[model samples]
Target: MRGSVEHSWGWGHCAPSPLLLLTLLLFAAPFGLLGEKTRQLLEFDSTNVSDTAAKTPGTPYPPYSLADFSWNNITDSLDPATLSATFQGHPMNDPTRTFANGSLAFRVQAFSRSSRPAQPPRLLHTADTCQLEVALVGASPRGNRSLFGLEVATLGQGPDCPSMQEQHSIDDEYAPAIFQLDQLLWGSLPSGFAQWRPVAYSQKPGGRESALPCLASPLHPALAYPLPQSPIVRAFFGSQNNFCAFNLTFGASTGPGYWDQHYLSW
Candidate 1:
C-alpha cells in the first residue's frame, strides 16, 4: 500500500502551495504593467521634406506645394460613409480594418506630388497659412454610449503653427464641454503637445487664442501634448496616454501673414 499525499491550508479545502502561489503572482505581474488601450490618433513623419529632397533643388524649400501632397486615410475598422476628411489630394482608403460602430478614424501623410516622400513632409510656409481639416460623427444616445473623448498630437518640431493656431468646435445644440490647456506643453513625452486654451462653445470658430505662460516661444523641437490641464478630464481625454476622438474642424491661420519653417501633423 502506498501513502497518499494531500495539500491543504488551515481550512478543510485543499489549497495551492506557497511556491505555486508565488509563481501565479509572478505570472500575473506583467499583466498589471500592461497599459490601457491606446488608439493611434494621428502620426506624421516630416523629416524628408528638406531642400535636398525636393524635386527641384533650390527652387524653394518644401519642393512640392502643400496642396500637391495627398492624404493617406486609414479607416482601420470604421464605416467608410460615416468618416470623411476634406484634404487637397485624393485619399487612399482601406476597408480591411475591423469596424467600430458609430466611430470613424483615419490618418494621412504628406508626400510629393508625383511619389510618396521618403519621409513625412513638414508644413512649411513661405507666404501663406497651411491647414488640414478633419470631421467625425458625434456619439449618439449620450452618456457612456457616447464617444469616450478626443486627443491630438504632432511628433516633429515645436509648435507646428507658432504664429498660427487650430480651431475646434462642435455643431450640436447642446453646449459641449471645454478642455483647458495642459499646464505643461509637452507632458513627460518626447513630443511637444499643443496647449489648447479654454473657449466658450458659443464663441466663433478660430476666434479664441491659446493662453501661454510666457510670450516667448520654445522654438526647439519637441513632441506636442495638447491636452487639458484638469487631471480627471485629462485622463478622460486620454491625453495622459495620448488618444482623442471628437467632432470638430481645425483651421490654421497666419492672420494675413506668413510663417516660416512651421510644422503640423495629422
Candidate 2:
C-alpha cells in the first residue's frame, strides 16, 4: 500500500509539444550578417593586393637604382626616407585570409629620382585601366593642403609627361578624395576636366599657372553607399614631400588608415 502511488512530471510522461520546440528554434536562429567573403569585396581592411603582395603576372617589383627597398607605417609621418620595396617574387596564397575573389593586398612605399623622368614608379601595368586608390594618412606639411593623392595612367605615357596631353595640369595636386574627411582641412575638388572627368595631370602646386577651386563642395561623385563611383582605371603612383622628385614608394604603409580596406573601383 505504501508504493501504490505512481509519479509523473510536467509532460505527463510523453514528448514535448511542437510549439515549444519551434519557440526554442526561433530564439536560437543565427543573425544574418555578412561573412568574410563579403568583407573582402567591400571593406578596405579586408581587401588584399594578392597580385602585388604575391608574385603574380601583373605585379612586378620595379627595377631600383642605387638604393631601392624600404618599409614604414603610412600612419606614422615621423619615419625617415626608405630606399626600396619588395613584392612577392611569385604568387603565393595568404595563409591568414581568403576572399571571394582571388585578389590580395600588399602595402608598399618608395622614392623616385626627379632626374629619372619617371613621374610615377613603374610597378604594375600602366598601359591601360587599373584600379587606383590612395589615402593621405600623414604628410610632412601637416595640413589638408599638405597631404595629396594621385591617380595616373597604368599604361602608356602618363599625363604627367608634357607629351601625353596638350594642356596637362592635374599633376602635384591634393586628391579630392581626402576632402571627404576632415572637411576643415580640405574641401571638394575644383570645377574642371581634372576634377570631374578622369584625366591625367602634369603640373605642380606652386609652379602651376591656373587657379583651381579651393574646395570641391558636396564631394561630388559619392563613394560607396548609394552609388559607388566607377573603378579608378589608372596607374598607381605617388610622391614624397610635395613638389619633390617622383619617388615611387609602396610598403606596409602608404595611405590613410582606412585605405587598405577600401578602394575606389576604376
Candidate 3:
C-alpha cells in the first residue's frame, strides 16, 4: 500500500450513474473544502486554494489569496456559470489529503462548463492550452509572479497520461483527458512555493522525499525558503482545493532538483 497508485472507481459498489461516471478519476478531484480560521491561515477566506475564483473570467482573478480573502460558508470552488470540478473518488480515498489536519479533501483533473443546474457537471479538458489566470492561493492576490507548489511522485511520471484521452462521457461536454500533464510539482513546497529544503521522511521513499502521513509528528519535516507561501494552504493540502484556471498550466517544466509526480505522499 505504500507505493501503490489507485485507479478504482464506482464509490462502494453503487451502480455507475451519470454522476458516478462524471465523478471518475479521469474526471474527478478531491472536494475537501474546509472551513474558516484554518482556511484563512494562508490564503484568504471564500476562495479555493487554487486561487482561480473569477468574478467573470478576466485577468486578475480574486482572493483566498494570502492578502485577499476570508473563509466563511465555503463549498465548491468552481463558478457555476463558467466552471465546475468533480471528485475522482470518495474523500477518504485521496492519499494527498492524508497529511496535516486536512481531515477532508478531493481531487480534480480538469474544469468543465457549468452543467449542474440543468444536467450533471461536465468534465472539460483542454482542446488547447486552457489559459486562465492563476494565483498562488494563500498568498497576496497581487503577487510578484510568485511561486506555488505541491509534493509529487519521485519517478517524475504517473501510471498513465493525465486522464482518459479522447474519451467522451455522459455528463461531460468534452473529453476530460489532460494528456500533457504527466507530473505535478511541489518539489519543495510543503510550505515553500519556489524553494524549500526537501526532507526525507518515508522509508523506501518514491517521490521527492516526503513523510508518510504523520498523525502527530512533533518535528516539522520540511523547511520552506523565501518564506512560506501560505501556512493556511499547507494545513489543508488534501482537503482544500489548490488550483484554478488562472495559475494552472496545461504543461510546465520542472526545474533542477524538482521531481514532478502527481501524488502528494506516495
Candidate 4:
C-alpha cells in the first residue's frame, strides 16, 4: 500500500505562504506607489493679450502718468473683460485696480482646455501642488522700472467666489490657499531677450510658509536654469482637493511697460 502513495512538489501544487500572499496583494494594489504627473493648466500668449485688450474698455485718460508709469499701467493694454471671457468667466477685468482695503485683485482661471484628467476632482489632503510659469519681454524704451508682486488665490467660496472678493478688499487674513510671489521686474530688454521663471506652490493651508526657493533664469539673459530641475517639486500629492480654478492678481508694486512678448503657462 505504501508503494502506491505519491505526492507532487510542483509550484502549482504548493500554496503560497502568508508573506508571499501579502507581497502579491501589494503588487496588485499599487495606487500609492504610482507617481503623479505634472499638469499644465494654463498658457497665455500674445494672442491672449491682444484679445484681452480688445474686450476691455479703453481708458479716457492714461491709467497712470509717465512719472509713475511703473504703477498699474503694466497691464494697461490687457482688457479685463476680454481676459475673463477668454479664460474662464471669472472677474479679472482690471489688472491695475485695487480693492477698498488696498489688496490688488486679479481673479481669472486657467484656459479650460488645459485642465488635466489626472488631477483629482476634489481637495482631500494637504499635499496637492500647482505651478506658474511666466515669460515677460519689455519694450525698447528703458526707464525706472517697477517691481511687481503676484498673489495667486486657488480656492474660494460663494456663488462664484465671494470669499475671494472679500479677501481682495481686506489685508487682515492671509488666504490659506494663497501663494504670493514678490519682486518681478519688467522693462527695457534686448529684442530676443526673455525671462522665464516657473514657481510651484502647494494647495495646503500655510503652504507658502515653507522655505521653497524661487528659481529664475540667470542674470545674463543668455543663461538659464537647467531645464529639467529648476522648478522643483517640493511636496508630494496627498490630498483630493485639486486646484481647478485660479485667481491671479498683480500687486501694489507692478510698473507700466509694453510687454512685447509675454507668456504664462500652468
- Backbone clashes for every candidate come to 17, 44, 32, 11
List TM-score per model, in order: 0.21, 0.17, 0.22, 0.17
Per-model CA lDDT versus the true structure: 0.21, 0.19, 0.22, 0.20
> What's the CA error at residue 108 for candidate 4, in Å?
15
State the TM-score for model 1. 0.21
User: How big is the positional error of residue 68 in model 4, measured in Å on the Cα after superposition?
Assistant: 25
Q: Which stretches of candidate 4 lie over 4 Å from their true place?
A: 1-129, 140-143, 147-266
Candidate 2 accuracy as lDDT: 0.19
Per-residue CA lDDT of model 2 for 131-220, tens digit only, reads: 122222211221211112221211111222111112223342343221221111111221111112122121222111211211111211
> In terms of TM-score, which candidate is strongest?
3
lDDT of 3 by residue, 69-173 (tens): 222222354333333242212122323432223322222221222122221111222211111111121112222222122222111112221211122234323
lDDT (Cα) of model 4: 0.20
Q: How far out, in Å, is residue 79 in model 1?
A: 22
